[model samples]
Target: MTDTLKIALAQLNPTMGDIAGNLALLRKARAEAAARGADLVIASEMVITGYPTEDLVLKPMFLEAAESALQALALDTADGGPGMIVGGPWRQDPTARPPLYGKVYNTAYVLDGGKVTTHRTKHDLPNYGVFDEKRVFGAGPLPGPVNFRDVRLGVMVCEDMWKPDVSECLEESGAEILIVINGSPYELDKTEERIQLAVQRVNETSLPVIYVNQVGGQDELVFDGASFILNEDNGLACQLPAFEEALEVTEWYRGPAGWTCNPAHREAPAGGMEPIYGALMLGLRDYVNKNRFPGVIIGLSGGIDSALTAAVAVDALGPQRVHTVMMPSPYTSQESLDDAAEAAQLMGIGIDSVSIEPAMQAFNTMLQPILNGAAAETNAGDTTEENIQARSRGLTLMAISNKLGYMVLSTGNKSEVSVGYATLYGDMVGGFNVLKDLYKMMVFDLARWRNQVLPKGALGPAGRAIPERIITKPPSAELKPDQKDEDSLPPYAVLDDILKCLIEGEESVDAIVARGHDRELVNRVWRMLELAEYKRRQACPGVKITRRAFGKDRRYPITNAFRGPA
Candidate 1:
């Protein structure tokens, strides 16, 4: 038995489809590990193609490129440096396969002495909560441990570590310590949940576990990368930072009591809007930067949502790259205009005004025959006019996007979008939305949070990016005279709580009302949410910060008529 085993966890940021870049990162990490004399270096899940490759893994070229890169990495390790357990896509023969098989797995290759020794596939392909692994990866059988430098190191790629059976099987197969590689995305309290999960496995197996995760944003998903080591007793030995890239070697001792990692740095896990804010920053940054958008343009309404969206965009793309446009209508109050300008000054981004009244007037003139037809006779204060104004703003933003080469940033928060409060192709029009998963209440909280702290890794300067008045004022669409959001929907606190119950908990209205809400209100909220699924279906893709975001996470049928409570 080995007296000591040193393992280096490579908590890295890998760009999607950047095989050469990912390999270079792996080689550098390997070099760092070798310098530290680590026995084996471990990287996160799919470090070659980046995690959650989504539909890209379906392309044979992408799979082949990743495999080739993995081979290149293996050849480089021939220099007799530290052995590595690097994660990547591994293509299997598809002659005998099911429909869901990419035949390529979310796999990890254990390379030692210039050859790929053990290529382990991922078990437990998670289908829910921002993951569609089962669609892309064929399920791996229960993995056994790989004997590396006299240590039986069991590998669990991402989803494998989430459940018990994988670890149980590994333990039964004589695995001493577990090394878990993850592309786990950031959600509220997921860091602590990971620790607890690792603890559960350790308790079940009586072996220390090393949990390593990828750090960065991949489209909507943000991997926090709070990798750590847990002792056999489930005590935290070493912990890497969350939402950032890092690498550290942890020493382990294998005595009669099994393996125990040496005590190392313990990062105090960040909670509340800070982590959520960081997720938004990273998700937005990666989407804009990786896709090579010159900049982003946001229609700043001077409301909490748009203000917060602008703040996050500036923080993500920096002030120079974030452009704010105030497309005011006839009903747009002077207060909103002033606040928007103030917000732009604070965020250090340029703000321009394009009055939509001209467009609205032109639309009204053009649509007068249709809008003033028999349909107008029945309705007073019709929303058709409101939507026209909104669509005009949308048109202007799209034009700016086309002419100026700026990707439009949608500013709708989850609360408004959840109930279809946003106009179709109007406020919902954008290339991306960083605030899509954040509820209305969360927008207020994060705006306040952004003002207080210069969020770590944020490029924008601090100091009240969101005007305080914007947060304190009642949120409104200002499509008509005195248009407050509460007129169309319930209070945000009640609304957000109910949404949490329905969207995340999948709770019935009866269950929701049982939690002290009025039954009628729950039913109404449930109705709005159900009715809005169609709108959500057409909404732009956005960063997913919550456990159950609208797009990929929640898949409610639009044609369904299932109502809850009353």
Candidate 2:
């Protein structure tokens, strides 16, 4: 009997729908595990087709392709080397009529000694907040344990481990150890939650648990891989680094008392802005590279938002790989231009200057007929003219993006996007918005943090990359004469707090008003948020850094008439 076993947890990043590429990665991971003397290797859930494959699983050809890839991988695991557990989509038999036999299951298969031995599917399917697993997969029944040499192992996929009944079932089936494969996306404090859950399960079942997770940025979601192992005694044995790919090997020995985990190796904690910063960088790099963009282009308005975005782009891709453009209109201040130029210089990136005077004039000339005589004056409404300037600038940036092969990075903060302060199809025209989920207050904090502690191996400007004037200045769109953001919206400090309550806390208008906020202010903000749903739906994808983002994480109907009482 195998008294001592080496298990490898492959925490890797897999691209969606890239079956061949994903298979290659799996093979490479398997080789690494084998080299490290691992007796068994485990990967994250849905490793073949990637997590949250959504509608791709509905296609028969896609399932066949995934199955073929899995078979090829199983063949590669021949020669009685290390056993492998891989995740993919599996279809049940088509004959049984009552329970819908042809249902799809999010499954994991264990391949050992040149053959497929056991399979298990996810039982609990999550359907809230960026997940539609129930729409795709059928709930799987409780699976039995798999015997490997002397030890009995139970496998759980993703959501299975979240519930206590599954672990209890595994314990009842006489399993000595439980292994969970997850494709859990990163949320702030999610790692702590995972550790607590693992400890709880270990204490309840009196069996050691190994949790393996996927790592990478898929569209708006970022997965932080922090695989861990807990002993039957409810003690943490080992933990891998977050936001990275690692092949962690743990040794288990059968003692006189029972099976116990050996003193496992651990990596140093990569905290203090490392995880969030790396997530942002990876999201940016993959979004640009995966979309086949040659590089990225950003409009560097002389504001903290654009400055940070520019820095992020330069860090994600090299400075040479980024292009900056400063499109200043008539209302744009000379100080802003100077700061923008200084930022470009500091970052060692070139910038092009395009004045929007010509385009603004053309727009005004064209709109004169529709506007009639009274509204066509030079001194029109401040917001109307300011929005026109912003639209003109957006058009110019988009043209440059089209002329040159580059993806545009929008620089709007969450505060602006939340309040409908941004112009639709104007400043919002971009392939990706870097800080769309970041509040204005958090934006300032992040800028300060970046300046203080430069990220690992960052190549951008070192000390205070953002100009002091940009950070200190009152934020303005510079669309009309002396137009400041405060003129329209509340101060960022007050605005962000209210937004946090309304969006993240889901506070009603009455609740917000009850929190010492003015009744009129709460109602106005709520109205703005409700009206902005349509614009947000049309907005581009952005990295999600907040608990609730405007993208897939928060889905509100655009055509709803359920306004609160006035």
Please report, as a residue range, the 10-residue window in candidate 2 with the lowest summed lDDT: 93-102
Q: What TM-score does candidate 1 reach?
A: 0.95
In candidate 1, what are the lDDT values of residues 120-215, reduced to their tens digit?
899889887677887877888888888887888888987788789999999999999888988888888888888888999998999888999999
Candidates in order have lDDT scores of: 0.86, 0.84
Error of 1 at 174 (Å): 2.1
**Tens digits of per-residue lDDT for model 2, 1-566:** 77899998899888889899899999898898899898999999999988878878877778889989888888877776788988998888533233332288999898887777778988888887888888878989897777876678889998888879899999999988899999988876778888888888888898999899998878888888888888888777888887778888788997765577787767655665666676777778778876789998988888899998988888888899899999988778999999999988877899999988777777777777777643354635556666787888788888988999898898888899998999987899899988888899888877777767767657576776777788889999887788899999999998888898999999888888788888788878878888899989999888887679898788898888877764
Reference-based TM-score of each model: 0.95, 0.95
> lDDT score, residue 458, model 1?
86
Candidate 2: which stretches are off by over 4 Å? Answer: 94-102, 268-272, 374-382, 457-461
Count of backbone collisions within predicted model 1 = 0
Q: State the TM-score for model 2.
A: 0.95
